[model samples]
Target: MTPHPPTWIRVSECFLSLQGEGPAAGTPAHFVRLQGCDVGCHWCDSKYTWGKSGGREISIDDALDEVRSLGEAPMLVITGGEPLQHEGVYALLARSLGRWSRVEVETSGVEPPRMSHAHLFWNVSPKLPSVTPRWADTWAHARAWAQAPNATFKLVVGSERDRDDAVRLIAEHEVPAARVMLMPEGLTDDVVRAHAPIVVEACKRHGYRMSPRLHIWLWGPKRGV
Candidate 1:
């Protein structure tokens, strides 16, 4: 018998554009921005996603239809308030989109997906103190796929304290330094310029990789960008 893949997930926005963050930066891609998050980052740009009412809920099929409408982008980025917190959405998205595209999920690492297939790239952007321990709680599940090249762990830093905290978290998890990325707190260009150089220097000093916010540079904190 053929195995059944997960169902598609409901989402907020589905569009095509250049990936603006993580290792996939500059890559033209399709984005599936799922709504609703509880990670609680004071500086979160997508706070609107925390409320279910903020985005209209669509069926998994409709979401796929929207993606299909965009034609070919080769890559798909599934991001959310906290993607892992909503299992069915991304899993269905991953299974359905995997048929024709290279898929990636940008998560807070606060929850585990019920299903995570090999074809889907897992981008774990673990939140800091501004968020909750739930972010750290997802590490065990993510570590299960730690060996997969498609999986990358990222940390967003706002201050020197955040940098120190990220270092300790990476070490505690025994996650490979190479697999970890240090991203600046990029709410605005001024925010990026204010702290990006410091974070970049810190990345160099710590020998960790850095991830810049491509979306911010391309478009300020606007939606569907």
Candidate 2:
């Protein structure tokens, strides 16, 4: 019998680093940044990952093995320009089930999750009005994510309008307050710190959690941890 062909996906890069944002912040994780995205955020830190032009195609096995070679990773973080946009990601996660204690997916919630796993945790960031193709355009996907018990909401807020928009999304989607996290938006440590106070105050009043830019604090805008 003939062997099956290896599944491939465009990869921007892979690195073992501390999860920088969301509820899993500070946790040591092997990050798999798949390339390609259409939900454009003007302030996107990873504009380099906007398309397949910069990334190379790699098989799911090779991708996991590379991260494993990096050493012991406490968790696997499948992030992206938009991870769900890549079909091979579903296979990657399916294969990662027993390898990592848990798997975290950081998505813009623009594309729907095609499969669900018991140990998979989704950090769904619903885009606010500040970005094009923002939350209003893709909120249905977020609503779908909220329906899953393992999903968490991470709202990156930089202004009062963004904060208000986050609140409106939470209410409309019926997302649990305890499962919501507010992260400051910035590419530099100073900028992230400066915006943190607003997030802290917002979390305090709303009973939401605060997610720090731990990787930014540790590496200061550097890539690949």
Candidate 3:
């Protein structure tokens, strides 16, 4: 008999939605949103996931069963308020989605992810100081993975200072220009359009990719959208 794996994770929701950001934007995908976070970003859209006890605590098998019910998609996006909060999430992906799915993780880049043998595409968005407290250690971890081989570092620039900050972080982390993404910070359609042109121009000037927040445009920060 095989040993059963431990189940640990707070899941807010899961659904089929078009990829709303990064290299996979606009693509059809399955999303798994785990819960809990230590890093507090003021503008974090998913504040509902911050508490450990509020959301539904789900087993990996049950989560996979939900995914299975949806049939196959080209990719799966595992995200969270901080998905790495749960120890068992890594094994769950390895045992389940690793077989044929292209797995993508949208993270704040504060904690290192635990994944093995999956085509892991990491979209690492590090928080700005304006949104959270300054921690050299957390920033270090963000920098380390932000510059990892298979990861993309995205900085959400809301002001000129933010852009400059991202540039400095890139240098500090030794992240290549090719791997950097500059996304304007916006939570609404009007807000997105307002910031898009400026950030897009900045990306072109600095030779980085401009990541538009497609989820906001598609669903307007509505839950499960």
Candidate 4:
């Protein structure tokens, strides 16, 4: 007998948007934003997704159906309030693997990724000391993800100090410089513009890539992109 898929998953919002950050930037994609996150980053842009309760419940079928309806977008990004917080996410990713050319999971690196698949790409964003209190867990999770061939380390940089911290973390974890991305922490166009040069310089110095927040530049932190 075929096992049943999850009847419902706690979802904040799902939409079609361009890949806003990391190496896949500017690519058209489907986004599944899940609810609930315990990794409290003070500067989090998606704070609306921080709580589990406020989200609307979406059945697995409906969620998949929505992705299918997006017509032939090549990428699907399952982001969060820390997506790994939900068990249903694994099943969702498993179901999405073959359908999308790339299945990327954007995570906080506070929780270890429990599901593994050949096509899975992990965009592991490790919080710096300026934001999250749980450094040990975040570092450990980041290290694990770094070992995966398809995983990319996207460290959020708010200042020179944060850039230094990101450098140390990448070195400590032995993550490849090519797979490391330094993204400026900002919610608006001006903020991103102000920080972009600093982040760009840091990336050049450290041999890491720079990831800009494209959606924020295009839509100014608006919900639903």
Global lDDT scores for all candidate models: 0.75, 0.84, 0.77, 0.84
Candidate 2 per-residue lDDT over residues 60-153, each given as its tens digit: 9999999889988879999888888786777788888889988998888877766677888998887887777555756777767777768888
Better of 2 and 3 by TM-score: 2
What is the Å distance of residue 50 in model 2 from its true position? 0.6
Model 4 whole-model lDDT (C-alpha atoms)? 0.84
Once superposed on the true structure, which residue ranges of model 1 sit more than 4 Å away at CA?
Answer: 1-8, 113-118, 131-142, 145-149
Q: Give the distance in Å from residue 18's predicted Cα in candidate 2 to where it truly belongs.
A: 0.9
Candidate with the larger lDDT of 1 and 3 = 3
Per-residue lDDT for 1-225 in model 4, tens only? Answer: 988656678888888989999989999999989999988889888899988897888887688788668666888999988888787888788778898889999987877767677778999988888887876578876666877768888988888788788888788888889899998888988888887888899878879899989999999878887
**Using alpha carbons, what is the TM-score of model 4?**
0.93
> Clashing pairs in model 3?
none
lDDT of 1 by residue, 49-118 (tens): 8875567666667776787698777787878876766646644664565455578888776665445566
Lowest summed-lDDT stretch of 10 residues in model 1?
90-99
How many clashing residue pairs, candidate 4?
0
Rank all candidate structures by their lDDT, best first, as comma-separated numbers: 4, 2, 3, 1
